[model samples]
Target chain A: MDAFQAIADPSRREILRLLSRDTMTINALADNFDMSRPAVSKHIKALDSAGLISIQNIGKERYCILNQEGFDELQEWIDYFDTFWKSKLKKLEMLLNEKAGK
Target chain B: MNRDIVHRWQFRQSPEIVWEHLTKPELLSQWLMANDIKPEVGHKFRFTTNPLLKFGFDGIVYCEVLEVDPPKRLSYSWKGGPGNGKIALDSLVTWTLTLKDGGTELLLEHTGFSGMKNYFGYLMMKNGWGSKIRKRLGALLAGPGK
Candidate 1:
Protein backbone atom coordinates (compact mmCIF):
# COMPACT_ATOMS: atom_id res chain seq x y z
CA MET A 1 0.00 0.00 0.00
CA ASP A 2 1.11 3.58 -0.59
CA ALA A 3 1.95 5.89 2.30
CA PHE A 4 -1.40 7.57 1.81
CA GLN A 5 -3.26 4.33 2.21
CA ALA A 6 -1.21 3.49 5.27
CA ILE A 7 -2.10 6.73 6.99
CA ALA A 8 -5.62 6.90 5.58
CA ASP A 9 -7.00 5.45 8.76
CA PRO A 10 -7.82 7.82 11.59
CA SER A 11 -6.30 5.51 14.20
CA ARG A 12 -3.09 5.12 12.26
CA ARG A 13 -2.93 8.89 11.72
CA GLU A 14 -3.33 9.33 15.45
CA ILE A 15 -0.54 6.85 16.04
CA LEU A 16 1.69 8.86 13.73
CA ARG A 17 0.79 12.05 15.57
CA LEU A 18 1.78 10.35 18.82
CA LEU A 19 5.03 9.03 17.43
CA SER A 20 5.80 12.46 16.06
CA ARG A 21 5.99 13.68 19.60
CA ASP A 22 8.29 10.94 20.92
CA THR A 23 9.30 7.34 20.53
CA MET A 24 7.31 4.83 22.50
CA THR A 25 7.19 1.12 23.06
CA ILE A 26 4.50 -0.86 21.25
CA ASN A 27 2.66 -1.41 24.52
CA ALA A 28 2.74 2.29 25.39
CA LEU A 29 1.60 3.21 21.92
CA ALA A 30 -1.23 0.71 22.22
CA ASP A 31 -2.38 2.26 25.48
CA ASN A 32 -3.23 5.52 23.77
CA PHE A 33 -5.89 3.81 21.69
CA ASP A 34 -9.02 2.09 22.97
CA MET A 35 -8.50 -1.01 20.94
CA SER A 36 -6.96 -4.42 21.22
CA ARG A 37 -3.16 -4.61 21.46
CA PRO A 38 -3.13 -6.76 18.35
CA ALA A 39 -5.06 -4.14 16.39
CA VAL A 40 -2.60 -1.48 17.39
CA SER A 41 0.23 -3.82 16.43
CA LYS A 42 -1.39 -4.27 13.03
CA HIS A 43 -1.49 -0.52 12.52
CA ILE A 44 2.17 -0.21 13.53
CA LYS A 45 3.00 -3.00 11.12
CA ALA A 46 1.23 -1.11 8.35
CA LEU A 47 3.09 2.12 9.16
CA ASP A 48 6.37 0.21 9.33
CA SER A 49 5.62 -1.49 6.03
CA ALA A 50 4.85 1.85 4.42
CA GLY A 51 8.08 3.29 5.86
CA LEU A 52 6.13 5.62 8.11
CA ILE A 53 7.58 4.23 11.32
CA SER A 54 10.70 2.49 12.53
CA ILE A 55 10.48 -0.46 14.89
CA GLN A 56 13.57 -1.28 16.91
CA ASN A 57 14.02 -4.14 19.32
CA ILE A 58 15.49 -2.56 22.40
CA GLY A 59 16.52 -5.64 24.36
CA LYS A 60 13.24 -7.34 25.33
CA GLU A 61 10.89 -4.65 24.06
CA ARG A 62 10.31 -3.21 20.60
CA TYR A 63 10.21 0.56 20.24
CA CYS A 64 8.52 2.52 17.47
CA ILE A 65 9.61 5.91 16.21
CA LEU A 66 8.72 7.98 13.21
CA ASN A 67 11.05 7.08 10.37
CA GLN A 68 12.58 10.27 9.08
CA GLU A 69 13.96 8.75 5.92
CA GLY A 70 10.62 7.26 4.98
CA PHE A 71 8.94 10.65 5.15
CA ASP A 72 11.65 12.06 2.89
CA GLU A 73 10.89 9.55 0.16
CA LEU A 74 7.17 10.29 0.37
CA GLN A 75 7.10 14.10 0.51
CA GLU A 76 7.87 14.35 -3.20
CA TRP A 77 5.39 16.60 -5.01
CA ILE A 78 4.77 13.78 -7.46
CA ASP A 79 3.11 11.87 -4.65
CA TYR A 80 0.31 14.42 -4.56
CA PHE A 81 0.19 14.54 -8.33
CA ASP A 82 -0.17 10.80 -8.31
CA THR A 83 -3.71 11.39 -7.11
CA PHE A 84 -4.06 14.44 -9.30
CA TRP A 85 -3.30 12.36 -12.39
CA LYS A 86 -5.87 9.79 -11.43
CA SER A 87 -8.52 12.48 -11.47
CA LYS A 88 -7.08 14.19 -14.55
CA LEU A 89 -6.96 10.93 -16.45
CA LYS A 90 -10.53 10.23 -15.55
CA LYS A 91 -11.34 13.55 -17.18
CA LEU A 92 -9.35 12.40 -20.17
CA GLU A 93 -11.46 9.28 -20.28
CA MET A 94 -14.55 11.47 -20.33
CA LEU A 95 -13.16 13.57 -23.16
CA LEU A 96 -12.44 10.42 -25.09
CA ASN A 97 -16.01 9.37 -24.54
CA GLU A 98 -17.23 12.70 -25.87
CA LYS A 99 -15.05 12.40 -28.94
CA ALA A 100 -16.35 8.89 -29.59
CA GLY A 101 -19.93 10.10 -29.31
CA LYS A 102 -19.36 12.88 -31.80
CA MET B 1 15.70 6.77 -3.35
CA ASN B 2 13.85 7.22 -6.64
CA ARG B 3 10.58 9.06 -5.97
CA ASP B 4 9.05 8.80 -9.40
CA ILE B 5 5.25 8.67 -9.50
CA VAL B 6 3.82 6.19 -11.96
CA HIS B 7 0.17 6.26 -13.04
CA ARG B 8 -1.31 3.76 -15.46
CA TRP B 9 -4.67 3.79 -17.21
CA GLN B 10 -6.41 1.70 -19.80
CA PHE B 11 -8.54 3.73 -22.16
CA ARG B 12 -11.12 2.60 -24.68
CA GLN B 13 -9.39 4.21 -27.61
CA SER B 14 -6.77 3.21 -30.15
CA PRO B 15 -3.14 4.13 -29.51
CA GLU B 16 -3.31 6.27 -32.62
CA ILE B 17 -6.22 8.21 -31.22
CA VAL B 18 -4.61 8.57 -27.80
CA TRP B 19 -1.46 9.77 -29.54
CA GLU B 20 -3.27 12.91 -30.64
CA HIS B 21 -4.18 13.80 -27.07
CA LEU B 22 -0.56 13.37 -26.06
CA THR B 23 0.96 15.23 -29.00
CA LYS B 24 -1.49 17.90 -30.14
CA PRO B 25 -1.07 21.02 -28.03
CA GLU B 26 -4.79 21.85 -28.07
CA LEU B 27 -5.88 18.33 -27.17
CA LEU B 28 -3.14 18.07 -24.54
CA SER B 29 -4.37 21.24 -22.86
CA GLN B 30 -7.88 19.80 -22.51
CA TRP B 31 -6.56 17.46 -19.84
CA LEU B 32 -3.22 18.90 -18.73
CA MET B 33 -2.51 22.61 -19.31
CA ALA B 34 -2.18 25.13 -22.11
CA ASN B 35 1.12 24.86 -23.96
CA ASP B 36 2.96 25.59 -27.19
CA ILE B 37 3.94 21.92 -27.42
CA LYS B 38 5.56 20.56 -30.57
CA PRO B 39 6.37 16.95 -31.42
CA GLU B 40 10.03 17.41 -32.35
CA VAL B 41 13.09 16.59 -30.33
CA GLY B 42 14.93 19.61 -28.79
CA HIS B 43 11.90 21.83 -29.36
CA LYS B 44 11.31 24.31 -26.54
CA PHE B 45 7.87 25.03 -25.08
CA ARG B 46 6.15 26.78 -22.26
CA PHE B 47 3.04 25.46 -20.49
CA THR B 48 0.80 28.17 -19.07
CA THR B 49 -1.82 27.51 -16.45
CA ASN B 50 -4.00 29.43 -14.00
CA PRO B 51 -1.93 31.66 -11.76
CA LEU B 52 -1.58 30.64 -8.12
CA LEU B 53 1.18 33.05 -7.15
CA LYS B 54 0.59 32.71 -3.45
CA PHE B 55 1.90 29.16 -3.61
CA GLY B 56 4.82 30.28 -5.79
CA PHE B 57 3.21 28.81 -8.87
CA ASP B 58 3.70 31.52 -11.50
CA GLY B 59 1.43 29.52 -13.81
CA ILE B 60 4.33 28.70 -16.10
CA VAL B 61 6.27 25.52 -16.88
CA TYR B 62 9.45 25.54 -18.98
CA CYS B 63 9.88 22.41 -21.09
CA GLU B 64 11.89 20.91 -23.92
CA VAL B 65 11.08 17.96 -26.10
CA LEU B 66 13.34 15.07 -25.08
CA GLU B 67 12.03 12.02 -26.95
CA VAL B 68 9.18 11.43 -29.33
CA ASP B 69 8.03 8.12 -30.80
CA PRO B 70 4.74 8.99 -32.45
CA PRO B 71 1.80 6.93 -31.10
CA LYS B 72 4.09 4.96 -28.80
CA ARG B 73 6.18 7.18 -26.50
CA LEU B 74 6.82 10.80 -25.52
CA SER B 75 9.12 12.34 -22.93
CA TYR B 76 9.94 15.91 -21.90
CA SER B 77 11.45 18.01 -19.16
CA TRP B 78 8.89 19.51 -16.71
CA LYS B 79 10.17 22.57 -14.82
CA GLY B 80 8.56 25.67 -13.32
CA GLY B 81 8.29 28.01 -10.30
CA PRO B 82 10.11 31.23 -9.24
CA GLY B 83 13.43 31.32 -11.08
CA ASN B 84 15.85 33.55 -9.29
CA GLY B 85 19.17 31.88 -10.11
CA LYS B 86 17.90 28.72 -8.39
CA ILE B 87 15.97 25.89 -10.00
CA ALA B 88 12.99 25.07 -7.83
CA LEU B 89 11.40 22.14 -9.66
CA ASP B 90 13.12 20.04 -12.32
CA SER B 91 11.82 16.66 -13.51
CA LEU B 92 10.86 14.54 -16.51
CA VAL B 93 7.46 13.26 -17.66
CA THR B 94 7.44 10.25 -19.95
CA TRP B 95 4.30 8.83 -21.53
CA THR B 96 4.14 5.33 -22.97
CA LEU B 97 1.28 3.91 -24.96
CA THR B 98 0.64 0.22 -25.67
CA LEU B 99 -1.90 -1.27 -28.02
CA LYS B 100 -4.46 -3.30 -26.12
CA ASP B 101 -7.31 -5.62 -27.08
CA GLY B 102 -9.87 -2.85 -27.66
CA GLY B 103 -8.05 0.31 -26.72
CA THR B 104 -4.76 1.67 -25.35
CA GLU B 105 -2.83 1.33 -22.13
CA LEU B 106 -1.06 4.53 -21.01
CA LEU B 107 1.77 4.83 -18.54
CA LEU B 108 3.04 8.08 -17.08
CA GLU B 109 6.33 8.16 -15.19
CA HIS B 110 7.34 11.47 -13.59
CA THR B 111 10.76 11.23 -11.97
CA GLY B 112 13.70 13.07 -10.39
CA PHE B 113 12.75 14.22 -6.90
CA SER B 114 16.15 14.16 -5.19
CA GLY B 115 16.21 16.07 -1.92
CA MET B 116 14.21 17.89 0.74
CA LYS B 117 14.31 21.21 -1.08
CA ASN B 118 12.60 19.88 -4.22
CA TYR B 119 9.99 18.14 -2.08
CA PHE B 120 8.89 21.46 -0.58
CA GLY B 121 8.96 23.21 -3.94
CA TYR B 122 6.58 20.59 -5.28
CA LEU B 123 4.07 21.03 -2.45
CA MET B 124 4.11 24.78 -2.88
CA MET B 125 2.66 24.31 -6.34
CA LYS B 126 -1.03 24.59 -5.35
CA ASN B 127 -1.58 22.30 -2.44
CA GLY B 128 -0.39 23.50 0.94
CA TRP B 129 2.64 21.19 1.14
CA GLY B 130 3.65 22.68 4.46
CA SER B 131 0.31 22.02 6.12
CA LYS B 132 0.11 18.46 4.86
CA ILE B 133 3.57 17.01 5.52
CA ARG B 134 5.39 19.52 7.68
CA LYS B 135 4.24 17.97 10.93
CA ARG B 136 5.85 14.71 10.07
CA LEU B 137 8.99 16.38 8.72
CA GLY B 138 9.11 18.67 11.69
CA ALA B 139 8.97 15.66 13.92
CA LEU B 140 11.77 14.08 11.98
CA LEU B 141 13.84 17.16 12.56
CA ALA B 142 13.22 16.95 16.28
CA GLY B 143 13.59 13.20 16.33
CA PRO B 144 14.86 11.47 19.43
CA GLY B 145 18.58 10.64 19.60
CA LYS B 146 19.18 13.09 16.75
Candidate 2:
Protein backbone atom coordinates (compact mmCIF):
# COMPACT_ATOMS: atom_id res chain seq x y z
CA MET A 1 0.00 0.00 0.00
CA ASP A 2 1.15 3.52 -0.80
CA ALA A 3 0.91 6.55 1.48
CA PHE A 4 -2.43 7.64 0.02
CA GLN A 5 -4.00 4.23 0.38
CA ALA A 6 -2.75 3.82 3.94
CA ILE A 7 -4.31 7.11 5.00
CA ALA A 8 -7.59 6.64 3.09
CA ASP A 9 -9.31 4.53 5.69
CA PRO A 10 -10.17 6.03 9.05
CA SER A 11 -9.53 2.74 10.79
CA ARG A 12 -5.98 2.56 9.50
CA ARG A 13 -5.30 6.14 10.48
CA GLU A 14 -6.70 5.48 13.94
CA ILE A 15 -4.46 2.45 14.30
CA LEU A 16 -1.42 4.50 13.30
CA ARG A 17 -2.37 7.22 15.75
CA LEU A 18 -2.60 4.69 18.51
CA LEU A 19 0.72 3.11 17.64
CA SER A 20 2.40 6.49 17.57
CA ARG A 21 1.86 6.83 21.29
CA ASP A 22 3.32 3.41 22.12
CA THR A 23 3.80 -0.06 20.72
CA MET A 24 0.97 -2.52 21.40
CA THR A 25 0.23 -6.17 20.95
CA ILE A 26 -2.37 -7.25 18.35
CA ASN A 27 -4.84 -8.29 20.99
CA ALA A 28 -4.41 -5.01 22.88
CA LEU A 29 -5.20 -2.94 19.80
CA ALA A 30 -8.15 -5.13 18.87
CA ASP A 31 -9.71 -4.26 22.19
CA ASN A 32 -9.98 -0.59 21.21
CA PHE A 33 -11.83 -1.08 17.92
CA ASP A 34 -15.16 -2.78 17.42
CA MET A 35 -13.77 -4.89 14.57
CA SER A 36 -12.76 -8.53 14.80
CA ARG A 37 -9.18 -9.76 15.18
CA PRO A 38 -8.92 -10.69 11.52
CA ALA A 39 -10.09 -7.22 10.48
CA VAL A 40 -7.56 -5.56 12.73
CA SER A 41 -4.87 -7.86 11.42
CA LYS A 42 -5.77 -6.90 7.88
CA HIS A 43 -5.45 -3.23 8.79
CA ILE A 44 -2.07 -3.92 10.37
CA LYS A 45 -0.96 -5.72 7.23
CA ALA A 46 -1.86 -2.74 5.10
CA LEU A 47 -0.04 -0.36 7.40
CA ASP A 48 3.00 -2.59 7.37
CA SER A 49 2.94 -2.73 3.60
CA ALA A 50 2.79 1.06 3.46
CA GLY A 51 5.90 1.21 5.73
CA LEU A 52 3.89 3.17 8.28
CA ILE A 53 4.03 0.47 10.95
CA SER A 54 6.21 -2.46 11.91
CA ILE A 55 5.49 -5.71 13.68
CA GLN A 56 7.73 -7.76 16.00
CA ASN A 57 7.10 -11.16 17.53
CA ILE A 58 7.76 -10.98 21.24
CA GLY A 59 7.67 -14.62 22.24
CA LYS A 60 3.94 -15.45 22.06
CA GLU A 61 2.47 -12.05 21.24
CA ARG A 62 3.23 -9.74 18.31
CA TYR A 63 3.55 -6.01 18.89
CA CYS A 64 3.06 -3.20 16.40
CA ILE A 65 5.15 -0.02 16.45
CA LEU A 66 4.83 3.17 14.45
CA ASN A 67 7.61 3.90 11.96
CA GLN A 68 8.01 7.55 10.96
CA GLU A 69 10.82 7.21 8.45
CA GLY A 70 8.40 6.64 5.56
CA PHE A 71 6.97 10.11 5.99
CA ASP A 72 10.23 11.62 4.76
CA GLU A 73 9.14 10.96 1.19
CA LEU A 74 5.95 12.93 1.83
CA GLN A 75 7.96 15.71 3.41
CA GLU A 76 10.17 15.93 0.33
CA TRP A 77 7.08 16.39 -1.84
CA ILE A 78 5.67 19.16 0.41
CA ASP A 79 8.97 21.07 0.37
CA TYR A 80 8.33 22.04 -3.25
CA PHE A 81 5.25 24.05 -2.31
CA ASP A 82 7.15 25.74 0.51
CA THR A 83 9.74 27.02 -1.98
CA PHE A 84 6.93 28.62 -3.99
CA TRP A 85 5.48 30.60 -1.07
CA LYS A 86 8.85 31.97 -0.02
CA SER A 87 9.43 33.46 -3.46
CA LYS A 88 5.97 35.04 -3.47
CA LEU A 89 6.46 36.58 -0.06
CA LYS A 90 9.80 37.96 -1.14
CA LYS A 91 8.17 39.63 -4.15
CA LEU A 92 5.57 41.17 -1.87
CA GLU A 93 8.27 42.47 0.40
CA MET A 94 10.07 44.13 -2.50
CA LEU A 95 6.86 45.67 -3.84
CA LEU A 96 6.02 47.14 -0.45
CA ASN A 97 9.48 48.56 -0.14
CA GLU A 98 9.30 50.18 -3.58
CA LYS A 99 5.94 51.79 -2.80
CA ALA A 100 7.19 53.13 0.51
CA GLY A 101 10.20 54.73 -1.22
CA LYS A 102 7.85 56.94 -3.29
CA MET B 1 3.84 9.22 12.77
CA ASN B 2 6.32 11.77 11.50
CA ARG B 3 5.13 15.37 11.76
CA ASP B 4 7.03 17.42 9.18
CA ILE B 5 7.23 21.22 8.93
CA VAL B 6 8.71 23.28 6.09
CA HIS B 7 9.88 26.90 6.12
CA ARG B 8 11.26 29.06 3.33
CA TRP B 9 12.87 32.46 2.75
CA GLN B 10 13.98 34.82 -0.03
CA PHE B 11 17.37 36.30 0.62
CA ARG B 12 18.69 39.47 -0.96
CA GLN B 13 21.82 37.67 -2.09
CA SER B 14 22.98 35.15 -4.60
CA PRO B 15 22.74 31.44 -3.93
CA GLU B 16 26.52 31.44 -3.65
CA ILE B 17 26.52 34.07 -0.93
CA VAL B 18 23.62 32.50 0.94
CA TRP B 19 25.29 29.15 0.63
CA GLU B 20 28.48 30.59 2.00
CA HIS B 21 26.69 32.15 4.95
CA LEU B 22 24.94 28.88 5.63
CA THR B 23 28.06 26.77 5.55
CA LYS B 24 30.57 29.10 7.11
CA PRO B 25 30.70 29.06 10.89
CA GLU B 26 31.47 32.76 11.35
CA LEU B 27 28.77 33.97 8.98
CA LEU B 28 26.21 31.59 10.41
CA SER B 29 27.00 32.83 13.89
CA GLN B 30 26.08 36.35 12.79
CA TRP B 31 22.53 35.46 11.87
CA LEU B 32 21.96 32.05 13.45
CA MET B 33 23.96 32.13 16.68
CA ALA B 34 27.49 32.15 18.03
CA ASN B 35 28.91 28.67 17.49
CA ASP B 36 31.35 26.54 15.58
CA ILE B 37 30.34 24.44 12.59
CA LYS B 38 32.75 22.11 10.80
CA PRO B 39 31.86 21.93 7.12
CA GLU B 40 31.62 18.17 6.82
CA VAL B 41 29.06 15.44 7.24
CA GLY B 42 28.72 13.92 10.74
CA HIS B 43 30.39 17.03 12.13
CA LYS B 44 28.71 18.46 15.23
CA PHE B 45 28.07 22.12 16.14
CA ARG B 46 26.54 24.23 18.85
CA PHE B 47 24.65 27.55 18.78
CA THR B 48 24.35 29.59 21.91
CA THR B 49 22.36 32.70 22.74
CA ASN B 50 23.64 35.67 24.68
CA PRO B 51 23.85 35.17 28.39
CA LEU B 52 23.05 38.81 29.17
CA LEU B 53 19.72 39.09 27.37
CA LYS B 54 18.81 35.51 28.23
CA PHE B 55 15.90 35.81 25.84
CA GLY B 56 17.39 33.65 23.11
CA PHE B 57 17.60 29.88 22.82
CA ASP B 58 17.61 28.37 26.26
CA GLY B 59 20.62 26.14 25.58
CA ILE B 60 23.11 25.18 22.91
CA VAL B 61 21.40 24.23 19.67
CA TYR B 62 23.21 21.04 18.70
CA CYS B 63 23.30 20.00 15.05
CA GLU B 64 24.83 17.33 12.84
CA VAL B 65 25.09 17.54 9.06
CA LEU B 66 23.11 14.85 7.26
CA GLU B 67 23.49 16.00 3.65
CA VAL B 68 25.16 18.89 1.88
CA ASP B 69 24.60 19.70 -1.81
CA PRO B 70 26.03 23.09 -2.60
CA PRO B 71 23.80 25.90 -3.92
CA LYS B 72 20.86 23.52 -3.73
CA ARG B 73 20.39 21.65 -0.48
CA LEU B 74 21.66 21.06 3.06
CA SER B 75 20.09 18.81 5.69
CA TYR B 76 20.88 18.32 9.36
CA SER B 77 19.55 17.17 12.70
CA TRP B 78 18.84 19.80 15.36
CA LYS B 79 18.44 19.44 19.10
CA GLY B 80 18.00 22.26 21.56
CA GLY B 81 18.11 22.31 25.35
CA PRO B 82 16.43 23.92 28.31
CA GLY B 83 18.47 26.25 30.49
CA ASN B 84 18.00 23.96 33.42
CA GLY B 85 19.60 20.89 31.80
CA LYS B 86 17.05 18.80 29.94
CA ILE B 87 17.69 18.38 26.21
CA ALA B 88 14.86 19.33 23.90
CA LEU B 89 13.46 17.21 21.11
CA ASP B 90 15.60 16.27 18.14
CA SER B 91 14.35 16.95 14.59
CA LEU B 92 15.74 16.81 11.06
CA VAL B 93 16.07 20.15 9.24
CA THR B 94 16.86 20.79 5.60
CA TRP B 95 17.66 24.00 3.72
CA THR B 96 17.49 24.36 -0.04
CA LEU B 97 18.58 27.31 -2.17
CA THR B 98 17.52 28.11 -5.74
CA LEU B 99 18.70 31.03 -7.80
CA LYS B 100 15.91 33.42 -8.81
CA ASP B 101 15.78 36.59 -10.88
CA GLY B 102 15.85 39.04 -7.95
CA GLY B 103 17.59 36.99 -5.28
CA THR B 104 18.07 33.50 -3.87
CA GLU B 105 15.12 31.43 -2.74
CA LEU B 106 15.69 29.64 0.56
CA LEU B 107 13.67 26.60 1.62
CA LEU B 108 13.82 25.06 5.08
CA GLU B 109 12.15 21.84 6.15
CA HIS B 110 12.07 20.21 9.61
CA THR B 111 10.59 16.77 10.13
CA GLY B 112 10.82 13.63 12.28
CA PHE B 113 8.78 15.07 15.10
CA SER B 114 7.17 12.31 17.11
CA GLY B 115 4.04 13.62 18.88
CA MET B 116 3.56 16.70 21.00
CA LYS B 117 6.25 16.59 23.65
CA ASN B 118 6.13 19.93 25.41
CA TYR B 119 3.99 23.04 25.10
CA PHE B 120 6.89 25.37 24.29
CA GLY B 121 8.51 23.11 21.70
CA TYR B 122 5.15 22.78 19.96
CA LEU B 123 4.52 26.53 19.91
CA MET B 124 8.02 27.48 18.73
CA MET B 125 8.16 25.08 15.78
CA LYS B 126 4.47 24.65 14.91
CA ASN B 127 4.98 27.05 12.03
CA GLY B 128 7.80 26.32 9.59
CA TRP B 129 11.52 26.85 10.37
CA GLY B 130 12.56 29.34 7.63
CA SER B 131 9.82 31.87 8.33
CA LYS B 132 10.34 31.68 12.05
CA ILE B 133 14.15 31.86 11.93
CA ARG B 134 14.08 34.53 9.22
CA LYS B 135 11.71 36.71 11.21
CA ARG B 136 14.16 36.61 14.06
CA LEU B 137 17.44 36.87 12.08
CA GLY B 138 16.65 38.11 8.56
CA ALA B 139 16.99 41.75 9.48
CA LEU B 140 20.49 41.09 10.77
CA LEU B 141 21.48 39.45 7.50
CA ALA B 142 19.94 42.33 5.57
CA GLY B 143 21.77 44.89 7.65
CA PRO B 144 25.48 45.53 8.51
CA GLY B 145 26.25 43.84 11.80
CA LYS B 146 27.88 40.85 10.19
Runs in model 1 lying further than 4 Å from the true structure: A1-76, B52-55, B115-146
lDDT of 1 by residue, A1-102 (tens): 445457558788778777766889999999999999999999999999887799999999999988876665434455565787888899899999999999
For all candidates, what are the clash counts?
0, 0
Model 2 per-residue lDDT tens digits across residues B1-146: 22456666666667877787778877666555677876678998876754321111365667898888887888888765444544434567788899987778888776654222332223334423244333432332232222
Q: Which DockQ value does candidate 2 get?
A: 0.02
lDDT per residue, candidate 2, A1-102, as tens digits?
Answer: 554457558788778667656789999999999999999999999999877788999999999986655444333333532464465445544643454467
TM-score of each: 0.57, 0.43
In order, candidate lDDTs are 0.75, 0.63
Q: Candidate 1 docking category?
A: incorrect
lDDT over C-alpha atoms for residue A81 of model 1: 59
- Candidate 2 regions off by >4 Å? A1-102, B1-3, B50-58, B83-86, B115-146
- C-alpha displacement of A46 in model 2, angstroms? 42
Per-model chain B TM-scores are 0.73, 0.65
